[model samples]
Each structure stands twice: as structure tokens, then as C-alpha cells.
Target: MTNIQVLDNPTMHNLLINLSKEESFTFREIIEHTLESFSVNGERQYQPPPSIVNRPNGQNTLFRPFTSDTCIGTKITVESGPDGQGRKSPPHGVIVLTDSKGNPTGLLSSNEITGYRTSMNAFRFLGERMWIIL
Candidate 1:
């Protein structure tokens, strides 16, 4: 077993803000680096199996395991339909990050990371294409 830091959304956001200022950095560099992994020559140490997507009780769940040169992690999430009256939304799953030694390093909120990655990817893709149209 490896030591792991489990941080909630607020803690994670606060830490990231401080780190951004301290390093004088934004996520642009990180996102750009990640985008590089999508190119023609990017390497995958191991291929990913087909993801699992099932909807029992009319709810959605997706479980995916992926690897790269820097890390390996899994994201498991569930969506219990849309927002409604007087109902608390279900707590989604987590993104579990493990190191090269195969020991768990961190467990982060799935929603937070997923939202950020999705939004960034959309913007980067659109931004690149929009420049061409102008």
C-alpha cells in the first residue's frame, strides 16, 4: 500500500490557486503538454480496453482505465439523471491516480477533474479551429 492524499474539491481548488501563483503558471502549459499526447507519434505503453458504459435504472455510469508516459489512472463516474426537485444528486465516483510502482498516490473528485479536462479540451480544439476561420 502507498500513501495517498485524498482532497475534496475546495481543498484541491485552493491548493491549485496557490500553486499557480507560486509557479507563475496557468494550466495552458499543462493542457498543451497533454494535447501533445494525442498527436501522430504519441506513445501508449499499454493499450486501453474498451470502456464500460451501462445504464441500469435509467442512470449512466462510465468506467475507464487509461495510461500514458507519465501516469496511470482510472475514472469511474455515475450520473443519476438530471436535476429535479427535492432530490439530492448522487455523489459521483473518483479519479484514482497511482504511481509507476503501482501504488495509489491520490484520489481526486471525478467531477472536478472531468469538468476541467472536458472544458479545456473543448476550448483548445475550438480555439485552434476558430483561428483558421478568422
Candidate 2:
């Protein structure tokens, strides 16, 4: 992942915006000067598979995984917007299960993953402070 990737999604951007609002720091600033540095954008390029596997004058088989369980994997979640918000619209965020190569083997909303990551970071920060006190 790269800075380019983090700033790409609106939800993640919104989350970062919220973080900036609460933490009083820009997302870019945090990414540039943070204890836990991570690439925002991670990409997996497509590779065409061998033709012989198809048989009978087999053409090139592109093993590109798109947005589906058959291509990617199962979508575990699908919700209509955030709670306390009106209007039934497309869900926000997506949970994607990736393979060992980081290719998206599955897709879901980012809600749970985002929450867990944020919470764990918070816990780690507080825990470290508590340890210092003790």
C-alpha cells in the first residue's frame, strides 16, 4: 500500500478526515510522520495463465480476479449506509480477503476491519502509557 491508495477511497478518506478532526492532524501528515507506517495503496497486477491448461487450441487464460467470489471470493457483508443515517443507498466500505500474494480473494465492507484496527491502535497507545506509569 502507498499514500496514493489510502487517499483513494472516500470512506477511508472520510475516516482519515474524522481522525484529523478528532486528532487534529492531517492524514498525509500522520502517514509521513507516524509510528506505524503502512502503504495506503497496494496493488496486485494481472498475469495471464498458460494456454495448455485450457486444451484444444487453448487461448491465453487471464487469471485476473475481479469483484466476485468466483473471481475473488465471498462477500461476507453488505449494509445500507451507516446507522442513524437516512436514505437506503449502497453500503459503505468493503472487506476484502486476500491470498498469500495479497490478491483480493474475497470482498466485504471495511467496517469491522477498520474498527478493529483503530481500536487496537488505541489500546496499544493507552497500554504503553499505562506501562510507563507503572
Q: Could you say which candidate leads in TM-score? A: 1
TM-score of each: 0.67, 0.32
Residue 90 Cα positional deviation in candidate 1, in Å, after optimal superposition: 7.2
Query: Local error of candidate 2 at 44, Å?
Result: 15
Candidate 2 similarity to native, TM-score: 0.32
lDDT of 1: 0.68
Local distance difference test values of all predictions, in order: 0.68, 0.41
- What lDDT does candidate 1 reach at residue 11? 71
Clashes of 1: 0
Candidate 2, which segments miss by more than 4 Å at Cα? 1-91, 97-104
